[model samples]
Target: MQLRHFQNEFPYLVKALLSAKKAGRLSHSFLIHNDDGKLADDFSISLAQALACTNPLPDGDSCGNCVVCKQLEHRTYSELFTLAPVSKSRQIVIGVDDTIPDTMRWFRSLFHMKSSMAGGIKIGIIYDADCMNDESQNCFLKTLEEPPPSSHVLLVTANPFTLLPTIRSRCQSILLLRNKTSYEDEKIRGIAGIMWELMSSSNKISTAEECAFAMISISDNLEKFAEEKADVKWDRIFEDSKYLEPPAKKRLEKQHEAAISAEYLKMRDSMLSLIHSWSAQAYMLSCGIPRDSIANPELFPRDLNVISSIDPEKAYRMMRKSEDLLQILNWNVDTDLAFREFCMGVEFGK
Candidate 1:
């Protein structure tokens, strides 16, 4: 998508970057982060296009029809080098040999050559940058420390804490505003409904039981969804590797298992984020914030009338509790137990 497409969603960010570009003060390295990976990825591309566009719009966005913009959109631009996790382990490795593709060595070598287009900037983007192992990160860190002239590096990841503090400190960070939580899935909607009921109910004892059931249901559904997605992915790979030996096949099976676990954890984190947003909105409503100013205002709309009756201090405490729950889950605790504890511990009304 062109830069214009994101203007409505990220007007301040787009305008700031464009203004910096106009002043020839664009940072050489950036760390673009968001809970939604696709949004982060697209925004990075749009930012790069704006920097490289030969013909810019009046608002300082890239002229989408320009050859440079089109090439960047399709990722065919010679000046743009993109790297992502390619291994079954889903890692960006530091290759020992220079001939290997997408390794730190190869990525750095791209900048060593003359720019494919005269006076054009070289852009290197690392998608899922958190996948870079320690060695790979260290190798890339050198590039960040001493980047080539007229070159820009973009690191995109949903999880930024996985990156080293040194690496994070070296780049200009952009944290995108999260899009509204989507409850399009029936199961998710059910969970949201149960959560709202648990929060709003005057009878805490029975509501706790329902909250426990919702936690269990969410856990089960997350596992099933992850497994189904992994199965589809593994089947395609298995079909293409008909001649693989038994040992390799076994390794592939292990990779498939890892993929399933990864998928589950990713989805679980997303759910936790959603829960956090829910509590945050509750706190805001309790503080008398306008509905339009809050994120996910559409959630529990009918029940919002009762928010004024609830104690703002209690709502604020619940929001902090939600934050603590997220940190606790990150420690690899039992998901069901942690969720149950959180749900049961919630205090409602005054």
Candidate 2:
């Protein structure tokens, strides 16, 4: 997850950052844009390490074995501060805030403290910076305008355009494009791989139940992950709220539920996007497109012979059907029912 790992994908950006670090011309604020959350966060850490590493390689990469690099890896670095959305049911939530929260206030207060470590530059990262409400974003502007002498502020967001123009003006922008090689979910990959296999199979689908099973497996895994995430957040949120009044507590509960649901829908849409891509590629193959030109070659079937028999019209229909299902899901249709109906229609409606 270091800059070196992404050299093949984002060579220009990596080279620029390295050159900046090497020349001592690093900007005080950086706004990195990427919808892929984990990769961006990891790159932020690696960037921070490069900026603060006591001993760096000639190419301005962190040695990774140095004390500062090791501290960052373990999240024990005193000079590093990370602000990401709070978790609600395994989903990161910036929350709907009219004003800044106590945590944000506390984070803002840290600039007053002198670095306890030898590293001169303290790194402050705001993960999902776009999630900040208007009030919080305005409050956060001060740091960008007049940051400490030896501090670097890194703002990471999937959608940079959501930020106020003033905020965007103050920082350098780096856009990280999606690459199939970077996708990491084994189960989703497995489901997608099996899905293409089934679609290309000569045997007609046997029953609605069989088609339902595939979608259900993906849904079940997502639900389980969400539940586990929610459980963790529940313990943390309720364990210390012994003094809240009944009405206030009820309001907080409702907000929490809303945030969880919002996050779940986001995840659902992302999964559906992957399915759409696979189906679109199938359509491409049906039109005699080369296999090498497919965006996600890893998820495609090993054999291309099935493409000869696939009706280009049917493949186009399947792609459109996936888009329609996505729209149906957005309307709050029951996921299982929408997916089942979509699957059955696509597989057997001929």
Best by lDDT: 1
Tens digits of lDDT, candidate 1, 7-121: 7876556767778877878889998877787788888888888888889887678888888889999989989988899989999999997679978788888765777677887
Number of clashing residue pairs, candidate 1? 0
**Which digits, one per residue and each the tens of the lDDT, describe model 2 over residues 95-157?**
354244434555677754777765467989988887776666887888799887688899998
TM-score of each: 0.55, 0.49
Could you tally the backbone clashes for each prediction? Answer: 0, 1
lDDT of 1 at 330: 69
Candidate 1 minimal-lDDT segment of 10 residues: 183-192
Off by over 4 Å in 2: 87-102, 179-350
